[model samples]
Target: MKHSLIFITISTFLATIILTHQTSSIKCFDHPNPLNFHQKIPVNCEFATRSLKTKRKSSNDKFQIKFTCGMDDKKLCDKVQKGFESAGQIITSTISIEIPITIDASFYDFCKTDNQCSIDNNVVAGGANPARTIALMDEDGVERYYPQALVKQLPFEHHPNFGPFDILAKFNSEADYWFEGDDSQIKPEQADFQLVVLHELVHGLGFYSSWNDFFDFVNPKGLTPIPSVEGEVKENMEMIFNGFIENIFDKYLVILSSGEHASNITTIINTIVNEKGKFYETPKDFIVKFKSSPQYLQSQIMLQTATTPFALGFLPKNANSPSEAIVLETTLNPYQTGSSLGHVDYKTYVNTSDFLMTYKQDSGLTLGDFMSIGGNYTGGPIGPRLRQVLKTLG
Candidate 1:
């Protein structure tokens, strides 16, 4: 996701925003699309495998992967593809996956014209997400959405509708990226491609949060309404707002000040429904009372708290005390969408082993540089807290 914010008005909301899903064709990879805030698309149980070449893996490695590259230059494409392989190897070696994960990655010029690639351009470095998500009841009896890649590793019975590929990833080819395999000697002006790939791949594996400020106006708004599609084609697509829903990552969020779980507020907001057990008729109808209702006034505390520094935390499943909760990125003043609640605290993790998931990436530093500075260098970029979080997410 890009670090910049795009202010969207209600007049252009419907015309500009649309949900993300897997179709027969390939689309660009962008995360935190507001139209997909609470979308739940129908899933086809029948699995159809796509014809992509699988990457060669070590004999002792349990994790498997299939990679699809979308660039023309054979030399550059090979370098980018190898970077993905190296990143995938680190993840597989860190965590055990019974099923082979598929990734469709590309290096494209995000800035369409030559003039747009100026020094001041806010071009996206890379973006990735699960091709689809499945709704499943967790052990706590709450229904939460899980990424397709994570669901495949579980005992769940869901099937992929698109194909075997679980993640869709893309990178900006115009950006100054250090394509060499040796990440230790990266220059100060270039970003390490492998590090960026590793970070994006982790997001595809379920490191992102559904909680966002999509409905906020002057102050923060509550959780978004669950959305459903009404049209058969993209041009005529219509969205319907249903009940409230949260992702698996949101289940573990807590208020660091009060030691209160974030879901307590969502549980209250989820109860505001009509006689038919639905939220609202349309997105506009929901927005009308988004900040006016009494329930929303109460839940607004959690939403507003999301903008404070070191306020929100992620309490892992194996935490023995409240102090063990991992701090989330809530330091943004107005709560920037896609970068606020979706990442770790940049100030706290930037110089640590957990720097991979921070809000910003240092241009000059490599994985080795961070490891040397942070100490406790492991095999890959996945730090102790991050590894525990991903393992708990599964």
Candidate 2:
């Protein structure tokens, strides 16, 4: 039940209505017409039990924006706890990376479960990673301590001041948000509660992937799918792995589709632990072993369109001219394992204006980067090629 990415950047606003949630009827994706939205703002309902926290700062910044509502309206949990304290003061005025963090959220009025994370417009409150995978190459490796990516140019090494707030998010108090209520901002026909709390706090701040803890460290029986026989799964199962990746987002994951950067994350987990072919014991879903290896899935879609080149920029489908090339859904769609293989395709940057890390936030584009696709928007708070792709991850 841990799969976060309904950002509505998983968004559509297409009102493909479907409701049902009580005793597990679960079927999200809602929208009727402000059955009730912002309802003329007036938060801090003063109800405090399950959750409610606040501690803002200024002169040198400080953070703490929490709120939890199971019921007892407190004005819809103080309008999404003051719209995540106004999206945590716009992510503390574009990052320098400070900790003592807490952006914890929860509302839940219904939409019980296709695995409980609401599912109407395909469940619109996903950003659930509690990412805690640290163990770069054991001197002992079993230690396990986590919390990285506060992004001051993070290459790796976290948990110092502690941020990545120990997970606690759940939304859908009957859908249709559109915060900043008494309206000063958040106006794009609403549904931008601080751009889905800055895209689920950027995967609870780690930009995600322990590759499902390396598929539960080589499928100790979890992601359930290894009955291969048809074409005998091979295109890079690299002979059914022994690569042992403990996840620092799999050391900057690379297949680079051979546009170069050859193969990363310890050379594709030691090229699937030194492949000798003729193998196949267990484990699956790296897109089912890269689609059973059709030339390593056309060299990993040619290294995800040669490293997300604005995903074939502004689609004439030329992805922005490498002599009219095109691939720009900005990589990682492989059937969405670990939240759309680490995000950014909100239908290929829906309408692009920084594209809140591409998944949904183009009410006409406000927060931006890709400087209209030439790329250069240091305005920060998550853009500029997703802050230069989370600074080449850990």
Candidate 2's TM-score: 0.26
Task: Identify the runs in model 2 with alpha carbons over 4 angstroms from their true place.
Answer: 1-179, 185-193, 205-328, 331-341, 346-394
**TM-score for each prediction?**
0.79, 0.26
Worst 10 residues of 1 by lDDT: 4-13
| Pairs of colliding residues, candidate 1 | none
**Per-residue accuracy of model 2 over 20-124 as CA lDDT, tens digit each:** 111111111111111111011111111122211222234343446556678776776787777667665665565544333554566766555333444334445
Q: Which candidate is the best by TM-score?
A: 1
- Candidate 2: residue 147 Cα off by (Å): 12
Tens-place lDDT per residue, model 1, 85-157, is 8888888888877666767666666566223353455555766677666666678887777777877666434
TM-score, cand. 1: 0.79
Q: Which candidate is the best by lDDT?
A: 1
